[model samples]
Target: VIDIFNNFALGICEGQQLDMDFESKTSVSREEYLRMIELKTSVLLKGALQIGAVLGGANEKDIENIGEFGRCLGLAFQLQDDLLDTYGNVDVFGKNIGGDIVAGKKTILTIETISLLGLKAEIFVELLQNKTLSRYTKVNDVIKIYDQVGVKQIAEALIEEYFKRAYDSLMKISVPDERKVVLIEIAQNLMNRQN
Candidate 1:
């Protein structure tokens, strides 16, 4: 348990460093972003599950399954958060939309759009880099580019992929199907969440 906690702490520190480093970077790969999130978000969730499984006296295989499930869930959750930052309703999501856009956060949407647009991405990049643009205009413009490149659909597809992997991991646990109901319900709710 102590070791799990220590590992989680170290992973979080490293992930945060990577996240900060990516901010000024001109290029960031999808894999690198995924790895950063895995360390930043997934490791904490995985540690919690692993500690719980250990306390519950689960076998090593069951612990491993739980860890995988937690890791994937964390990834999907963070992706959903990124999507909500731009697309969610302010009333429902309890925050102003387009925070990520205004801050020039390199979410999956922007990263993929950069890759897909190539030379065409210059306009999009310019919009983000412009210091004088109004917040609403910048966000709306960036969102337009995102729509043109189908970035939302791409992000949704990736989120679904992670959720599916989480489900698979949950199913592999040794517990009976009935015992997995709560976890399944929670995951389903998370997948469908709007806020």
Candidate 2:
């Protein structure tokens, strides 16, 4: 149990620090951000799937294949989480929407768009820090930033990367397509999900 916790801890810490560094306007290259995401989130999901497949009597090849599939889905899942934290309903989610924005946690969309948006980034960053600003104003300011930096488009592209990897992994599994199709459908549905 300790090892399991330890294995997970490293990635979780990396993810948290990555978000903090990104959001606080600290320096982070795009490569550094992706590396952090893959380590913190996707690695755990991949491990779980691999261990389950092995314990269930799957061959090494099959386990490896499923692990890759899980990795792709996990990446997409984390990215969707970032999107939701920005755009989803707070009441239903049971957390403050755009907490990430206020915290300045660097996500893929945020990191990617900052350079593209130029001076507007500075304005939005300031607005995010203005304690007197209303929630409505704060949200609108973020939306404007999103529009300027093309966050929506960037999200779509990142999700597409996950989907493509997932597809290839599904195709690699030696199991019947009928048995594997369910997982593929799950991946597809996750990619399209809004909440």
Candidate 3:
């Protein structure tokens, strides 16, 4: 238990540090972004499931499978969160849209938008980094760039990939098929949620 908790904490800290480090850079590769999220977001879920499996007397194989499920689900969840923060309806999403844009957070959408835009990415990044721009204006400009570059579709596809991975991990577990139904439903609901 102590080991799990300690490692989880360290992983989260490392992920956050990477996030901060990425903020100053002009661009981040997709692989690097995934690694950061896996450490920062996935570790929490992985640790929780591993700890739970241990308490439940799950064998080593089951523990590994459950941890994989949790890790994949965590990635899916974070991707959805990134999508919602950019594209979701304010009323349904229960938070202001484009918060990530306002904060200049380098999400997958941002990276893709920059990569697709080439020279024009400088303008988009400027708008994001500009302290003088109103929040509404900054978010609006960034969203416009994202739309022009088809980032929403790209992000949705990536989210789907993670969802598929989560399902694959769940399938590898030795539990009866019926026992996995609730987990499947939860994953579906999470992927399909508006908020």
Best by lDDT: 1
Top-down TM-score ranking: 1, 3, 2
lDDT of 2 by residue, 27-121 (tens): 46667877778777887877777777767788889878888887788887888888778877776656777776766567776767765766656
What lDDT is reached at residue 160 by model 2?
Answer: 85
Candidate 1 lDDT by residue in tens digits, 13-129: 999999999889887889999999999999999999999999999999999999999999999999999999999999999989999888988898889999999988788788888
TM-score of 1: 0.97
Model 3, residue 113: distance off in Å is: 1.0
lDDT of 3 at 21: 98
Segments in model 1 whose C-alpha atoms lie over 4 Å from true places? none
Q: Give the clashing pairs for model 2.
A: 23-104, 23-106
> How many clashes does each candidate structure show, in the order listed?
0, 2, 0
Task: Tell me the lDDT of candidate 1.
Answer: 0.92
lDDT of 3 by residue, 17-40 (tens): 999999898889888998899999
Question: TM-score for all predictions?
Answer: 0.97, 0.80, 0.93
Candidate 3 Cα errors over 4 Å, as ranges? none
Error of 1 at 85 (Å): 0.7
Which candidate gets the maximum TM-score versus the true structure? 1
Candidate 2, residue 39: lDDT: 74
After superposition, the stretches of candidate 2 with alpha carbons farther than 4 Å from their true spots are: 1-9, 20-25, 89-96, 118-121
